[model samples]
Target: MPEYRRSLDIYQGYNYKKDKQTPVGYLTKIKVAGTDLTVDQTCKDPTNPTTDLKCVAVLSGALWETGVTDAVYLSGQVSAPNRQTLASLIINSLTSVEVVYQFAVYDYDPVAKKYYLAFHANQTDMNGLLEKRGEDLNVSVADDASTEVQSPINYSFQIGIKPQPSAQTLHIATADQKNVVKSWGLALG
Candidate 1:
């Protein structure tokens, strides 16, 4: 079997307003490409923080306030007879993979003049692989017997804010919850 390296790309979308917009809300789109898909790691326990945990990529200057959503595998090579089985396998494996996010929340009560901070996280097992979009999986096979077949597949996700108590919300609120915002604000002096 041939070995392939995984390549991942993340894209972020934002909305800016003249003066009314909060300038805090945004969305993230992730694309992962690789071959012989398999689950590298399961969901991590929230109480335990380890280096082995798989975390959603955090971008600079932006707070990830949402868990991954709308995760799906897409391919243009699945329709090919030779690639169908591989595509099916990839899809099946991805369905078992779980993506999780960790974040913090900061709540302020103006009337009471009190502030509350909390940490939160959540995970979602990919169960929607059965839905197929775009062309079937297709990839070129090595002709030489000594050469291994190389198959590439693509998966995507939409990471965004959810309701309160969710991981996304926590992540978005981390800066405020941790008082990083206050520290940074003063550092500007």
Candidate 2:
């Protein structure tokens, strides 16, 4: 069996404005391709810091302050077969977002590796202006292949509720809660 490993890429200390109409901090934004897609937004305190000042163990302590917070946007493209479905996707607000996805298409040559965009359902909330609306485009992936994946696959993620901090991580696994939760690389023990 190929050993499966997961890693994260983080960009630290991006700034944000608290008083904006959209409280979610948007550090940077990037446009994806000929189609409409974008990334990089805001982050918020998911929960109270684990420990107090005496021995603070907050995962995102620095950002917990009520004022300004940092944000980071994800960048990638979306690909789908003729069909489009609106799906609720959960991404790591702090970098440990997990989901089950399928490969939109199979590779023609096993010797060579290629990446393609996966399609996902778009909910009714889509503001009509999807390009700048901050909606994520789901990328379809195969569960069987993903379960046995040993390396990171290039995927187009749906725009998360907020921009994930650099400290956050991404996980892809089978949709089954058991497999999805268990197969994650950055799970909290």
Candidate 3:
């Protein structure tokens, strides 16, 4: 539902603090509330809006990422009741839902204290949804498997997200910082 252009300006935000280690490129590591989020983080939507998407608050959420090739795993802590909220949705034909996700990738350097947006996962073009898997459906494929996701204590649900091809990648012009942060629901640290 959004248009595309070849020109892109990866945002260089005001964040320059090196308080903690942030894994650069592909965003392999992510944390919420000091807890190590276990899922691989990536662009939730292909459009990858420069502006932020609406964000909903969950008390404790263990988000999922079942990806291939450049695997982006996103795992977090979800309270039992919160987990139930997602459970009912993966019923009937609707296998999953994009609850609260807006992909904003960055090429960050902690030491240098600089970062830029690589892509945005807009709500309209997102490719994955959060899903709960039963033991029967949780078997490994080929020799490739996710040991972290297989453990019950680690996570109770799963979601797979695949990156869009480079040829298909598109960008939209971004708003100024206030509007961008507001629309993006980005929490300033």
Candidate 4:
């Protein structure tokens, strides 16, 4: 059993106008606000880092398929403010923006006392609106007062991802964090 850190990296690219740049390469800290529980792993435990994950590392997939789409699940526990922000982030990036959404699930290296990314992904064939969080609906006829207690929102969105070789490797391969841009966009800070 080892501690893990899962993060979502949204590609920084030109704005909808394609005139100026937007926030470039922001690694979104994926977390469920107000809830203290750790989220579950969505992708498979990455194979031997020392062996697998490099270019041409694997032999084949089932039949003619060389790779498979890894589905990443979001917990329904995400707060309302977060969901609204996520929705805004997903807008327009699906096509013209060419925003590449990536995910990093890190394997904690105890000896180093730090987290190193293991798995990665980028945006592919999917609609951003599809990543919709649950919305409230009014119902006239509801359950009786004696019915079971109210269940917390369990709605979630799924991001289908393919392995991000470059980002994943660079995460550990990089000698220092200086080259890695701390923040981006108009600020560039």
Winning candidate number (lDDT): 3
- Writing each residue's lDDT as its tens digit, candidate 4 over 105-171 gives 3334445444344333322212111222344211011112211112322223323222222222112
| TM-score per model over all chains | 0.21, 0.16, 0.32, 0.26
Sorted by lDDT, highest first, which candidate order results? Answer: 3, 4, 1, 2
- Tens-digit per-residue lDDT, 92-136, candidate 1: 534322222232222333443433332222232212122233443
Model 3 segments more than 4 A misplaced = 1-18, 24-73, 77-82, 91-101, 105-107, 110-112, 122-124, 128-157, 162-189
Cα lDDT, all candidates: 0.24, 0.20, 0.28, 0.24
Q: Write the per-residue lDDT of candidate 2 for residues 1-189, one digit (tens) a residue.
A: 322221211111111122221111111222222122222222222111221111000011111111112112222222221112112122222222322121111011222221111111111111111122334433322222121222222223333222222223222222212121111122234
Q: What is the Cα-based lDDT of residue 132 in candidate 1?
A: 32
lDDT of 1 at 77: 12
Would you give me the overall lDDT of model 1?
0.24
lDDT of 3 at 167: 19
lDDT by residue for model 3 over 128-177, one digit each (tens)? Answer: 22332542222111222223333222223333333333212222223212
Is candidate 3 or 4 superior in TM-score? Answer: 3
How does model 2 score by TM-score?
0.16
Error of 3 at 167 (Å): 8.1
Error of 1 at 1 (Å): 43
Highest-scoring model, TM-score: 3
